[model samples]
Target: MNAIHNTYWLLAAAAALILIGIGSSLLARRFGAPLLLVFLVVGMLAGIDGPGGIRFDDVAGAYRIGSFALAVILFDGGLRTRRESFRGVFAPTLLLATVGVVVTAALTGLAAQWLLGLGLVQALLLGSVVASTDAAAVFFLLRAGGLQLRSRVGATLEIESSANDPVAVLLTTLLAEFLAAPSGIEGSELLRELALQFGIGALGGALGGFAIAAALRTLPLSGGLAALFLGTAALFVFGATGSLHGSGFLAVYVAGVIVGNRNVPGFANLLSVFDAGTWLCQIVMFLVLGLLATPHTLGDALWPALGIAAFLMLVGRPLAVALCLVPFRYGKREIGFIAWVGLRGAVGIFLASIPMLMKLPNAELIFNVAFVVVLASLLVQGWTLGLAARLLDVALPHRDRAVRRVELDLPGSLEREMVGYAVAPGATILIGTALPGWARLVMVVRNGEIHMPDVAGSLSSGDYAYLLAPPGRVYRLDWLFAPPDEAIEAEREMFGEFSFDADVRLADVADFYALPIRAKDAPLTLAEHFARRYEHTIEVGDRVRLGPVSLIARELDDDGVRKVGLKLERLGNVLVRRPWLARLLPQRFVAR
Candidate 1:
């Protein structure tokens, strides 16, 4: 009875922690801060030094829990990474993941050793710990900011961040072990170890992924059960790979990707379960890490930590990105944005916990410094990331996504769509207003709490509500949810291959696509230039064809043509006209 009572108390504490963590996330979101940063702050505030005064000094437990959390997070990242997503950016992504990471670690190691006065091995280990750009942080901020990036640049950064974690993990583990041992590290032996670890990791992950996909295909289970089974298999892969001294992280991640891409039973449920689990794990992991940190020691570690962060952000990250992407032909602006967005979060902190668990020299200090680096990254870099993207001229205009989403269930063969709405500030959707006949308000999430508001409850600003609605009525929902000004700004549909941007100059773009921009000397916008020769009736979606090029009006307001999309047809005819240029078609002429 006493043991059961203790268990209940633990559960109570966990529930409270989660509740507080969520509140912190909301506050952070409101203040334009990174959610993970707030989570860390809240955890620290609730710890021994702060008001809550809850003592937690379990380094080993935190390490174990954090590792498990990372495994789940990495697996989820892999699961969502579709093969088609990396189509043209694979080479650059691979280089950034492998070569860029190594350069970052080396440069950071040098800085740490010089400034922080740690020994070479220890400094190198610290470098390795923080070298990884946090996949969760980058993925979350980019997606949340609603910034569309030029395809190759965005995809490369996302893929690099996700794929590079395994490398950092491997380096951290090996370096940690090296620091713990007295044996002199030989160059040849180091190379062999690196090769072996990477080889086993890649091979194991590929095979494990295939195995998981095959197993899921053979066994048909209910959604919940299928997700449980998939989670179980992931754990199994991680454990089994570890038993063979392989990269368990890589194995788990690859398995997730393969399983995700395959036609698995209960795929949506799997994604949903993993998403929830990953969030929970992230919270618990960060909180536990914060609890482990002694606030008193941070005062001394703060300056040194900031110095290291400055060097990494200002010097190491950019250097690495530029060097690795040199051969890939990425523009300087795109590279600059990518360099600035290397926000360190959970992964760095997790690696920091390792040194503490090992009880290495100044382990506590290392942990403190590592945590501060994450703080600096998330607070400084993460906050300014979107702005930097815009300033660097690499940002894409946000694409309007389908607000209506449909999910189909197999057993019942039922199809359903849940349309989400954000009641913009000052937008009035009356509590008792009659909704469209095809729609029904299901639930409202206000200040992070879910409430099934009906006629009795008020709909106020910032309330995110969901509705079950037919696909056709999704557009009409704008008037109900969007602010008056937003409703006016919404663009009508356009026709084309959905290419190019509104902001680009026609003079700069004319010769590239061989566009029919006759007035090359005139300073005209893409939409403005196209509108002059465009004979089609001026509606929002009028398409104008000129030779092999197609131009479509993407956006229009009260004024005139706002944005135009361009698509160049096949260049076979162009190549036929100039036979000698046929050999360079795909490599040169067809680049646009």
Candidate 2:
């Protein structure tokens, strides 16, 4: 009966917590705040102090839950990473993960011992746990916020976040064991464990990802049941690898990336489902960490926590980013931006829970400090990211107009069947007003329209013309668009007859368009009129056409005209929305 009651109470607690999470997420937008912090606050409310007096002081349970949540989060993150993104950022990211983490841990531990008057081992425990930035939290928040960096600064952060977990975890565990046993963890043993964990983790992730991809292709299930299989397989890879003394997080992440990128049988819808799942994981993870805290203990750790946060943000992260990024030719702004954006969240809290689980001394202090650090990061770093970007002049100025490119969701299967070609300088149809041969212009893509061009419709030099040639002949659609250098001499044979230089002619009214003259231009065109017919160029009913585009001339005097150009109504360029920026983010992983 007691067990039954406990189960009911636990279910009720979970239900209430979910509602709180939902409410917090909804309210977060209004506050211009991060939802993770909100989730933690909500969890705190449910603790011993707030409305629901559910006392959850179970450190071991918290650690277990936190660990599992982290695994899920990391796996999801890994699955989404594109292999291509790793090429540029990998070296620096690796350095940040290994060298940077070690340096940070050592420095932070020293600081903690000096400032907080803690023993070396306890300080090391705290330092080791908090040393690495929380990749899951940082990556998720950055991506969700739709923040765009000029280059792979964001990717480096993400890679560091995902990769640093194992290092921090390794450090914390080793230190904990050393404290527990008089016989310290030998250097050789430490080295061996590190080697094994990384080696196995990487290998496991690769193998597991390959396996999952294969299963996704071969397996068949309807009603979106396949997503469950994918999810289960991912979690299995994570758990199985970890159980085998491998980095399960690594395995799950690698597997997810592989499967996410592959042309699976049917995962378009599954991606959305998994995204939601990841969000759920984050919310639950943060909230659980918050619930495990006691407001009473936090007060004592507050000062130390603030100290650590300041040192890490001001000194450690910046130094690490500088050391790692300098060799990569990253500029001051890039390094500065990377340093500012190292927002910590779940991983630190999760690491804190580990010490608590082991019943290590000052566990509560660690938890409080970790929470404070997360809060500081979200408030200080998260909010100021855009401002920092601007101050650093890292952002490019907005253009007056932009063109939207056609995004082809071409089937991979059909890739082998199609041949893509760019309208080259020497192409018979594109050169000097000559139209493309019907054979070459099998399909012309212009302004989002794909159609067979009429013989009279000339192929402009910039057009992308598709040929109906067999696809297996080329490796990629891009290959079809290769420059003349890659083309056969026979391909160039068609260009010899075309004129290389032709004086392009515009219509007679190229510069002279018949429109209601503006007051400023009125002096130029209708000044001889006996009476002033209208406000001139400054009048409301003025319009002009430039090529296929139209322009609206606002009524303005000479000085005004000098300052402001004609207001273009629908500029010649198509207003391309930012490539579904967030949607493109998911695709980046596949590229890797």
Candidate 3:
């Protein structure tokens, strides 16, 4: 009876903690507090050091929970990552994940040696523990804060965060092993292990992802069952890879990328379920780590930990980033933003547990110091992320509000999905904006009445319209249903006053705007000029300056750029160059 009562009490307490963490997310967002920090604080408050006074010291259990949670978080991150994002960033991202991690660890290890008075191996281990940027922290803060960063910058950060964990884990484990028995390991064996970890992890992930995606497509699973199957299959891959002595974190993340990019059944269901699952995992992981920490013992190490954290944020991360990115010709602003966003979170704490698991000398000191560093990071770096992005000009200048979109898998086809959208008052669709040829409206619900596309005639405000579109292409239809007042205004300001077909010749634009162009290049179309300027894929919002005018890619398709918008760099300069155009053109065009 006592055991049963104790079990019940434990369950209730656990439930209460999770609920508090979930509820605290709202408050965190309101106050611009990092959600992970809030969760950690909640767990701390419930610990022996704080008011709740719950005595918990389960290091192994916390490590286990954290491993599982991080796996899920990485898998989800991979799933959400688009293949297109890797277009031009693959090389630089890889370097950042591998070479960059090493440099950061080296620099930070030096700081730890000086401040904490730790030996060489121990200092490096400490540095390795906190080396990788946490995927959960990066993903959560970016999404929750509603930041839409530039494509290159965002992709590099996301992919780097997901990919670098394996390196950090390997380094931490290797150092821990060396600390445990310095005589047993050889240099050649270390190299072999590194090769095996990455090679096998990548190969296993690709194979496993393909297998899961095939199963999802071939099996008759649906709804919740399909989502369940996906989660379990991913875990199986993770465990299998780890059992084979490969990096399970890398394997699982890669598998997610493959599976997510493939057209599998119940994709929408999988996304919805995994989104919730990752959130739960993050909260649970942070809470467990928090409970494992002995806050009272941290006072001795607080100042040194703070110094290390400051050095990491100011010197270590920035120096490493600049070295890795300068060869790639990344702009100063892009490098600065990426360096600042190298936030340490759950991964560091989780890695610190390894030393505890190994029973290393000064393991407690490492754990406490790591805890302080993570706390300081989340408090300072997380809070200022949005502000830094804005000041650094890495964030794209556009409203990133949520669109009311619902996606349902088509019964017989993987190529198409049934997507529904709520028509806003000033939607472009209401003004007869045509959707892409690939999209076809099939149904409309207006004021509680269901009508076929033909019966509905035209979509009106307050109508719910459903269209059949390729699974991943539904986002292209968003602008048609979006309330365009703000979006249109913003686009006009950013792009230009007017748009012209990309096929328009540079000579014609130069003649009209009274701008000089090289005679050899004058015959080239705007699209051709953009193609020449950018060796990689040219996305919308890409701009090219032409004397006092700027040409922006307004619209693009598979064929190439479809439309180009032109903006005068300085209205006064343009007027001075072509004085008569002030009287000939409307005030809108002349005033820029």
Candidate 4:
């Protein structure tokens, strides 16, 4: 009965923590905040430092949990990554992963030594902790940003984060060993061991990938079973490689990619499973790390942590990005965005625990500092991501999924397939344009409303164009959905999806559309004009629709909208049971 009670409490505690995590994640999503931020904060709140007073100080247990979480995240990253994406920016991204890690480590190490007054190895260990761009954070940011990057830049950053994790791990392990003073290990042996870890990790991952893919293709398993098999195989590879002193990160990731890329029954469903599992893993890992830190110790190292974080952000990252990309060609803005976006997440904090586990001097202090750095990175870099991307003109309007997915559910039929594509701005094909003989345009979904295109119609930017095509010949649909061919793609200034040039002013916007703007609002800048209307903070991407005109907060900080984009609708297009009903509603209502 006592055992049963203890088990019941354990289950309840786990359930409560997980519920908070999920709720926090939903809140983050709604507010355009980083999900990891909520996870970390909720964790801190659940720890000894907060009211619940849960005391968790098991370093070994934390490390073990972290190891599995990292493996799962890596595997998911690898699975989702496209080979073509890698092929597109291989040279620069590869260089960035390897050379960039070295430069970032060295620069950050120097700063740590100077700022924290630590010894060489200890400083380097701190450096290694933060050396890699976190795959988990970067992946989430890209997905949650609700914007698609220009293909090259997005792919490069994604690949760089995944590719560099092992490098950072190796560096941290080596530095921790040296810091703990096992000086008798020869340089040659160290190199050989490092080589073995990479070699075996990659090989194990590839083998696991093939095995999973083969099983998926041959077996008539349900989606749940497939997910179960995939998870089991992934964990097996991670464990196998780790036992052999190999890079478990590399093995699981490689395995995931191999399985993910291949066409298998329930592959899409498998991906969804991976995504959920990865989220759970990230939440658990970060929460445990947060629980490990004592709030008072973190307070003592506060200033040094801030200084080191600043150095890493302002100096170390950009310098490393510039130096590493010297061999390849990337514009300054792309490099700048990349530099700013190198967020530290689960990996950095996990690496910080290594020194503590090894009983190195100042290990707890370093852990505290690492926690601080992760906090700063997520809070600053993560928050400003969408704004920075737009300001740099590196983001392409993400219209790729304009339509809600529709399935035929036809009995015993495999010939016909349904597909959805978002009509990008500047697309050449109009709505009424004829599709290929093999396919038929079925529906258009816009602004959360679906309209069946039973007759020919014109398509516009942000319109979800749904079509049906014979599965084998669906390739022809690409031509119609492709963006317009133009001499140079103009970066249209967006005020809510309406495109205008920089010279366009508030008065011009009102006058051109015959919309009323008060004399008080006339002189306000785009960002300032919107600021006058909101009673509360307006986050980036928040929208306020004024009957026919929409105002979107394009660039936002703590100070509300830093930039605004406007969209105007033809007054005639407004639909109402009684036209006066539209006129009676509030002119502006904000959407979360």
Global Cα RMSD, each model: 12.9, 15.6, 5.2, 11.6
Better of 3 and 4 by TM-score: 3
Clashes of 2: 19
The residue pairs in collision within model 4 are 402-464, 403-464, 431-458, 431-459, 495-565, 495-566, 496-565, 496-566
Least lDDT summed over 10 consecutive residues: which range in candidate 2? 496-505
TM-score of every model versus the real structure? 0.72, 0.69, 0.82, 0.73
Candidates in descending lDDT order? 3, 4, 1, 2
User: TM-score: which is higher, 1 or 4?
Assistant: 4
Q: Write the per-residue lDDT of candidate 2 for residues 264-351, one digit (tens) a residue.
A: 7645566667777778788888888778777677766688788898998999878877987789777676788878877788788778
What lDDT does each candidate get?
0.73, 0.65, 0.86, 0.76
lDDT of 3 by residue, 304-392 (tens): 99999999999999999999988987888789999999999999999999999989999999999999989999999999999998887
Cα lDDT of candidate 2 equals 0.65
Shift of residue 468 alpha carbon in model 3, Å: 7.4
Stretches > 4 Å off in candidate 4: 398-433, 436-592
By lDDT, the best candidate is 3
Worst 10 residues of 4 by lDDT: 486-495
Selected candidate, larger TM-score, 1 vs 2: 1
Where in model 1 is the C-alpha error above 4 Å?
A: 144-147, 399-489, 492-592
